[model samples]
Target: MYLGVLALTAFVLTVFLLVYLGLFLGRLPFLQLDRTGVVLLGAIALVATEVVPLSGIGEVVHLPTLALLFAFMVISAQLRLGGFYDWVVVWLDRRALAPPVLLGAVIAVAAALSAVFSNDIVCLAMAPVLAQLCRARGYAPLPHLLALACAANLGSALTLIGNPQNMLIGEVLRLDFGDYLRVAALPVLLGLLSTWVIIAGLSRGHWLEASASLLPSALGRAGEVGVPLDRWQTFKGLTVAALLCAAFLWAHWPRDLLALAGAGLLLTSRRLHSRQMLGLVDWQLLVLFVGLFIVNHAMQQTGLPAQAVAVLADEGLDLQEPAPLFAASVLLSNLVSNVPAVMLLLPVAQAPVDGPLLALSSTLAGNLLLISSIANLIVVQAAARQGVVIDWRAHARVGLPVTLVSLVIAAAALLPWRA
Candidate 1:
C-alpha cells in the first residue's frame, strides 16, 4: 500500500512538471510537441496510469467553460467569415488618417472588438489584413501590429467573453457579467490608453516608410486575410453578438448556454455553411482546455497544491490575499502564458473579488513580454509575412512599461473592492 501511494504521487508530480515544462518552453524537447499536444499526452498518461479515470473526466473537466469558449469561437468565426475584420482595416487604410491617428484607430478597434470577441480570434482574423494595410499605406507594420496585439490583450479584460481565461474564471466563479465589467472597466480603459502612448512614443518619426509605399509585393499575402465584408453576414454576426452581451448582462440563463444558442443561430444561416463556421472554431484550443482540465484536476486530486498553499499561508504569503494573488498572477501569466497560469492559480480564487483580480492581472501581464500572449505572437507572425520583423527587444522596450502601468492600475482599482 505504501509503495503504491508513493509511486502514484511521484507519477503525478512528474507528469505535472513535464506538462508545465512544455508549457513554459512552448514545446517539448524530444517529442517536439506543441502546447496542446503536450497537455493531451500528459492527460492520456495519467488516465493510462489509472490516476484519473477516463469515465470521471466529465467531473474533472468543466463542460460549461468549454462550451462557452466554443460558442464564442463560433460567434467570432461568423464575423471573420463575413469579412468584418478585413473591412475594418480596409476602412482605416482608406481614411488616410495621420500616422498617430491611424495607430490610435487600430488600438481602439482592436480593443473594442476584443472586449466582445475572443482576443486570439480577433488577432488571427485582423492581423493579416492590418499588416497589408500598413505596408500599402507606406508604414512599417511594427507599430500598428503591436498596437493591435497590445490593445487586444488589454481590452480582453473588460468582460468575461473577451478571452478564454476570463471565460473560465467567470464560469468557475459564477461572477455576474455587469459586475465584472464594472470592476474591470477603469483599469482596461487606462491600459488601452497606455498602450497607445507607448507605441506612439516609440514609433515617432518612423511611422511612415516613405520609399516603401505602393510596393506591389506588399499585398502578396492578401490571400491569407479574412473574407470580404458581406454586410448582411456582418450584420447578422453583430446582432447576435449584441444580443448575447445584453443577455449576459441581464438574462438569468447560464452564459455558456446562452452563447451556444447564439452560435446555433449563426450556424443555421443559409448564406454560411455550418462546416465553414465550425472550421474556424479552433478545435486545438478546445482540446487543450479539455486536456488541461483533466491534468489540473489530477494535480488537484494529488493534494500537493493544497498542501503547498497551506505552507505558503503559514509563511505569510497567503494566496488568498489580494497583493500576493495579484503578484503571483502576473508572474505565472508571463511565465507559462495566461490560460495555464489561470488554471494553476484558480483554486485559491475563492473570494468574489478574486475573479476580477485574477482575470485582469493574468490577461494584462501578457503584454510584458513577447509571445507571452498568443495575440502578440499572432501579430508578430503575421507581420513577418509582410516583410516586418519585431524582435523581443523591441517588444519589451514598449510592452514592459505598458504592462507595469497596467498592473499597477489594476491592483489599485481591484484591491479596493476587497475592503
Candidate 2:
C-alpha cells in the first residue's frame, strides 16, 4: 500500500509538471501542445506509468459533466452557423453612440451573448468586428477589446451554457438552472459594473479621444461579407437553442442527444461548406476536458484529495464550507487556470451549493492574469491581428484590480448564504 501510494504521488507530480511545461513551452517531441494537448498527454503518461489502475479512472470521469459541456458546444456551434453573433456585432457597430456609451453598450452586449454562447467564441466572433469598427470610427480597439474580454468572462457566470466550466460544475452539482442563476445573478451584475468601471478608468482621458474621424489609411476591406440572411436557417437555429435551454431548465431530456440532433439538423446546408462549421468546433477544448477528467481522476485515486481536505480542515479551512473554498478556488484558479484547477479540487469537496461558488470564483478569477483564460487570450490575439496589441502589462492594469473587486463581491454575496 505504501509503495503504491508513493508511486501514485510521484506520477501525479510528474504529470502536472509535464502539463505546465507543455503549456509554457508549446512543443514536445511529436506534439505542438496547447493547454488541452498538455492535459491529454499527462493522462496518457499516467496510464503508461501504471500510476492509476484502469478501473480507478472511472471515479473521475464525470459523464454528466461531459454531457453538459458537449451539449453547450453543439448549441454554440449552431448559433455560430446562423451568424447570430456577427449579426449582433454589426448592429452594435452601426449605431452612432458616443465612445463611453458605446463602451457601455459593448460591455452589455458582450455579457449577454457570452451568457448564452461560449465566451471564447463570443470574443473571437466579435473582436474583429469591434476592431474594424474602432478603426473606422477612429477609436482605439485596445481598451474596448480588453473590455470585451473581461465582460465576456463576467457574463458567462450568468448561465450554465455561457462557459464550459460552468456547465460541468452545474451538471455535476445538479444545480437547478434557475436557482443557480438566482444565486449568481447579484454577483454577476456587480462584476459587470466593476468591469465597466475598471476598463473605463484604464482608458482614462483616451476615452474622450476615442472617436476621432477615421483616417483615410485606416480604411480597409471588409470581412467575408456574410450572405443575405437565410431567415429560415437562422430561425431554426434559434428555435432549437431556445427549446434546448428551456428543456435543460424544465424537462428531463438527454441534453447531449438533443443538442447533437439539433446540430445535425442544421447541417442540411448546401451553401455553407461543412468544413466551415467543422473548423469552428473547439475540439481541443473538448479533448482537454476529457484528458483532465482522466488525469484528475487518476490523481484522486492516490488519496491525496481527501488528505488535502483534512489538512485544510486542520488549518481551519474546510472546502465543504463556502468561504475558504471560495478563497482557495480563486487562488488555485489563477495559479493553473480555472478548468484544470476545478478538476483538481472538485473531487474532494462536498457541498450542494459549492457549484455556484466554484463556477463564480473560477470564471471571475480569469480576470487576474493575461494568460489566465483562453477567452482573454483570444481577445488579445484577435486585437493583434488588427494592429492593436494588449500585452501582459496592459492587461494586468485592468485585470488585477477587477479580479480582486469581483471576488470580494461574489464572496460577500455567497458566504453569508452558506452560513
Candidate 3:
C-alpha cells in the first residue's frame, strides 16, 4: 500500500508539473503543442500508462459541464451566422455618440452579450467590427477593443452561463442560479463601470487621434463592407436565448437540457445550415475542458490536493473560508487560465459563498494581465491583424487597475455576506 501510494503521488506530481508548464508558457517550447494540445496529451499519457484506466475515463469526465458548454457554443454560432453580433456593431456605429459615451455603450453591450454567450466569442465577433468602426471615424481602437475584452470577462461572472468556469462551479456546487446572480450582479455591474472609466480615462486625448495605420488586407474589404442583418434569423436566435435565460432564472428545469433544446431549435432553421453553425463552435475549447476534467480528477484521486488543503487549514489559511478561497482563486487564475484554476479549487469548495467567490475572483483576475485570459488575447490578436498593437504595458495600464478595483469591490460585497 505504501509503495502504491508513493508511486501514485510521484506520477500525479510529474503530470501536474508538465501540464501546468505548458499552460503557463501557453505552448510547449520548441514544439507546436498549444495549451489545449498539452492537456490532451497529458490525459492521453495518463491513460496509456494505465495511471487512470480506460474504463475510468467516463467517471472522470464531467458530462453536464461539457453539455452546457457545447450547447452554448452552438447557440453562439447561430447568433454569429445570423449576423446578430454584426448588426449590433453596425447599429452602434450609426448612432451619433461621443467617444466617452460610445466607450460606455461598447462596454455595456459587450458585457451584456458576454453575460449570455461565450465571452471569447463575444470578443472574437465584436473586436474586428469595433476596430474598423474606430478607424473609419478617425479614432483610436485600442481603448475600445480593450474595454470590450475586459467587460466581457467581468460580465461573464454575472451568471452561471456567462463563462465555462462559472458553469462548472454552478454544476459542481448545485448552486441556485437566481441566488448566484443576485450575489454576483452588483459586482459585475460595478466592474463593467470601472472598466469603462479606466479605459476612457487612460485614452482621453488619444480617442480622436489615429493610433495605427490600418492594413488593408488585415481589415478585409469584406469586413468593412458591413454585414447585412437577417432580422428573422436574428429574432429566432434571440427568442431561443431569451427562453434559455428564463429557464435558468425561473424554471426548475435542468440547465443542460434547456440549453441543448435551445441549440436544437436554432439548428433546425431553414436559412442557416448546420455546417455553418457547427463550424463556429469552439470544439477545441470543449476538448480542452474534457481533457482537464480527466487530468484533474485523476490528480484528485491521489489525495494530495486534499492533504494540501488540510495543511493550509492548519496554517490558518482554510480554503473553505471565503477570503482565502478568494485570494487563492485570484492567484491560481492568473497563473493558469481561469478554467484550470477553478478546476483545481473546486474540490475545496464547501461554503455557500465558495461558488460566487470562485466565479468572481477567477473571472476578475482574468483582467489583471494580457496573458491571464483568452478573451484578452483574442482581442489583441484581432487588433494586431488590423495593425493596431496592444502590448503588455498598454493592457496592464487599464487591466491592472480594473482588476484591483473590481476585486476589492467583489471581496467587500461577498465577505460581508459570509459574516
Q: Best-fitting candidate, measured by TM-score?
A: 1
lDDT (10s digit) by residue, model 1, range 1-419: 99988888889999999999899998998787999999999999999987999889899999999999999889898998998988888777767777799899999999999999988888888888888777776777788888889999998999999999999999999999999999999999998998888889898888877576543333324564557679999999999999999999999899999999999999998889999999888999998999999899988988999999999999999999988999899999988889999999999998888999999999999898997999999888888887888899988988899999998889889867787
lDDT of 2 by residue, 1-419 (tens): 98976876887977766775665454455766767778887888887776655776666677766665665666566666777767776676666566777789989999988887789988987887788777777777777888899999999989877888888777676678878878888999998898888888778778533347644323233544342335666677678778877877787666666666666766666766667766778788878887888777666666777897899899998887888888888887777788877776676557766888889999999889998888999998888888888999999999998889988999888876764
- Alpha-carbon RMSD, candidate 2: 3.1
- Arranged by lDDT with the best first, the candidates are 1, 3, 2
What TM-score should be assigned to candidate 3?
0.95
- Candidate 3 achieves a global lDDT of 0.88
- Name the lDDT of candidate 1: 0.89
For model 2, the run of ten residues with the poorest summed lDDT: 216-225
* lDDT (10s digit) by residue, model 3, range 234-345: 8888889998998898999889888988889888988888999899889899889988987898888888899999999999999988888999999999988999999999
Model 2, runs deviating above 4 Å: 1-5, 20-32, 49-60, 208-211, 214-230, 268-273
Error of 3 at 60 (Å): 1.3
- Model 1, 69: alpha-carbon shift in Å? 0.4
Q: Rank the candidates by TM-score, best first.
A: 1, 3, 2
Q: TM-score of every model?
A: 0.96, 0.89, 0.95
| Candidate 3 weakest lDDT stretch, 10 residues | 212-221
